[model samples]
Target: MSEPSAGDPGALAARLAALPDEQLLAVLVVATAGRDTLAPLYEAATRLLSETGQSGTAPGVIPGTDMPPGYGPSADLGSSSQVDSGIGAVVGDPAATGGTVGGYTAGGVPTFGSLRDKVERRIGTAFGARQLDRQTPAGRGTEEQWEAREQAARERLAQIRTSLHEGEGS
Candidate 1:
């Protein structure tokens, strides 16, 4: 296919649509052209398929990725045991490790969470709402308020931990 003119979105779309899915992904790889960035994406795509018990080459893979040449087929991604589904799917599953504890994240790192909570926190801070800080308190918050907030947070956290631990026991 002939290259689309620099400013023509319609032509570019047409050209992209003409190729198969694999070819389209290959084009994307070339456009971005970076190994460090693409490797995780490639791994995730290929692992998603494998986790669902369908093994095939995922087209998003570039030259440095584990996927085979030309992104033909994924028969080479090793065994299913080798694939880690990152942090997303681990939230609710019993076997998922380092993802859930009393429905809170296993690790402090939360890749995704309730949008409302994020928005509320953002708005709260923006509106000059006092946040709980215990480690150091001179001008930020009074000792009483800090202690109260800290106690409340700990209580809530404990309840969640207890509930999660109970769930695991059953």
Candidate 2:
């Protein structure tokens, strides 16, 4: 019979079936390495291997040997039923994690803090705040004006904190 086209699934299956166990295993390894784009090849190799009763054993492994449970190819990794079915119940999910679908939290609202924030806050308190205070223009103003500005800043900070800690402790 003439060789079949590369895109022909039937021809591919027939060719794979004709391969010896070792060559078929090599094909399987190569197919597995390119799994994202070679799923069909991988499946064909796996099917051929299984048909020949050489499903899971890799090179150097003796066929029909007593292998430990779960170490064999027949072992179950996980079933779909074992997965969390709740909506937005996955890590980095926007709905569950309170972030945008693009994986970014809203501006000025910290989704989480790290050691960097603590270190920066400490440094700011120690020196940066004093430098900023000195550089800030001190215009003549009433006590009420100063209090209003301070209160506004405090409110803004509180709002940001509240946004960051929305679902905590519940």
Candidate 3:
């Protein structure tokens, strides 16, 4: 077959089909990184791995084992058992050891709550004290009151101009 251009869909499909199962899995893993809405792609990769008798576990890990890495049936528990006992003691006595209880501090301060509640409380306190009248337009007075204020400002300006003129004549 002739070499096809990079933009050719047929060529791309052929090249992808020619890749081994491991390479295709790697490609799918890279494509799905930081992306959440690619369930079909994830399923395809899993199907390909299963078809090839490969597992999703790390290399050298037995597939059906429930133990974590570096831990097995014959794993040692020498000095670490003492450390584990100490942690157990601390976890058992929360109040005596000053540990947190139900996500609260030892001093009774709340350490867990939704941020939405706090935001709603702040907004309520800010807008609760002043009850707004829906019938009145905001930042505006009555027409007669506005006219009176404008007239008063005009008289003040006229008085200032008169004083400046009198000072100039003297």
Candidate 4:
């Protein structure tokens, strides 16, 4: 289905709902963290680096929206000003995305990075919870490395869940 314009609240809601579960989970992660929360984003981004390609646009000229200019009563869904567009731009490297969100390029396998670092970043974010981009180690490794990293992400997830639960109890 065509995405609704930013001005169309009803349609917008539908689009949000239609987004795939991964994207929805990412959105929920952001919402739970509060857009203003830096730690969570960095922690999430770190985990994402291990589990998924960085969010980004296509390498070539971005394919235009299916609709022609001025085609509908509602404004073009992709033409709205940045602020009007509720979501931030995707930020994946063309090579990593194979020019799209689908997956990595041919022969390009995904890998995981520092579990120690992931844990540190997640825990750091938990403690600092309000700050952004504190300490996330960067580099490369195979899926084996990801075992620890994924574990760290899971642990961080637990911490976040606990914090939320504690806040609710109050």
What is the TM-score of each predicted model, taking all chains together? 0.22, 0.25, 0.26, 0.21
lDDT by residue for model 2 (26-129), tens: 45644453335765665465456556655333323343345444333433323235433331222122233332111123221322222234565698797976
Q: Rank the candidates by lDDT, best first.
A: 2, 3, 1, 4
Write one digit per residue (lDDT tens) for candidate 4, span 14-84.
87799865555455433333234564663454355335533421112222223223221222223135332
Give lDDT tens digits, candidate 1, residues 1-170. 87778799998889789876555544553443234556556444434433554333222334234532312221121213434544233322213433221123323233332233466669988656444443446534577777899999999999999999999988
Model 4's lDDT to the true fold?
0.41
Candidate number achieving the greatest TM-score relative to the actual structure: 3
lDDT-wise, the better of 3 and 4 is 3
List residue ranges in candidate 1 displaced over 4 A. Answer: 1-4, 35-170
**Separate clash counts for every candidate:** 1, 0, 0, 7
- Cα lDDT for residue 51, model 1? 54
Candidate 3 achieves a global lDDT of 0.46
Model 1: lDDT of residue 129: 42
What are the clashing pairs of model 3?
none
Q: What CA RMSD would you report for each candidate? A: 18.7, 20.2, 21.2, 26.2
Candidate 2 — what's its lDDT?
Answer: 0.48
For model 1, name the residue pairs that clash.
Answer: 57-74
